[model samples]
Target: MMEDFSGLALPPLFGGHILETELDAAGVELTAGTTEILESGGTPQDIQKDTRELDKRKYQALSKRVKELEQVNERMLARLHRVQRLTRRLKKERRFLMKTLDTYGDDYRNAEITIPLEDEGGANLDGIPGGDDGGSSPSTTNQPACGPKKKRHRVPKEKERDAQ
Candidate 1:
């Protein structure tokens, strides 16, 4: 039996040798590829550099956006203050007008006297002592109504004669 097995080339045992050679070849290819990457300043360092650059750009963009938002916030606050001031002024004016209306309401109502439009003879003036007829009565006394009476200036007889 042993002599027969030695003469017969037993088919490759489960193809193990072929699989080992393939694995070795794959490992060599992987090593060469890694070496090439290492010669070009290594993958990790390149990735770190790229990450740093991206972070810098993002920070700049975010800072710029923050500045813009702050400016907008300031403008909005200014507008809000202006609106509040206007509202306060309007409220003060409204209160002042309301007080004025209250103060004058009674006087306005009392002073209003309506007369009939159909009175062609004009309003009756009998209640007042003075008549509607346009004339003034001569004063009974010599004293002025408003102030002290004025004295007449009399020229001397000699000056009057000389002037004549």
Candidate 2:
């Protein structure tokens, strides 16, 4: 009858045994049985293949993520460039405005403007009071520039109203 060797500890090469002396003492009989089971199961080779496949999938996913990040970086760089260009343009415009103000600001503020009068039926200032034609002063005029003042009617106090 064949003994059940399934529960027996495996050798160090198969990731089971802890001691080298135990592995060496296990001898050819146990090694042969273990080899037979390993060959039939194809476990080690399958595990290596599966690990390689998983590594390939992980590498592909990482590569895809890298590409996405690179695209985002490129877009951010483009937006940054646009902002920088606008900033440069605004700075240039500000400089130009400052230069213009430095050159002509005082002149514009202190310049006096005179309008020549046309003689074509415009209002005659000669007949008006306080005119340059040497008319009477504004105070000597009978009527004031504003209308005459009106007299105010005062309201009675509370005690005066009760007495009335």
Best by lDDT: 2
> For each candidate, what TM-score against the reference?
0.39, 0.39
**Which portions of model 1 miss their true places by more than 4 Å?**
1-42, 106-164
Q: Weakest 10 consecutive residues, lDDT, candidate 2?
A: 11-20
Q: Candidate 2: how large is its RMSD?
A: 35.3
Model 1, TM vs. native: 0.39
Name the weakest run of 10 consecutive residues (lDDT summed) in model 1.
Answer: 8-17
User: Measured by TM-score, how close is model 2 to the native structure?
Assistant: 0.39
Report, for every candidate in turn, its global Cα lDDT versus the true structure.
0.56, 0.59
True lDDT of residue 48, candidate 2:
68
Model 2 alpha-carbon drift over 4 Å, by segment = 1-41, 106-164
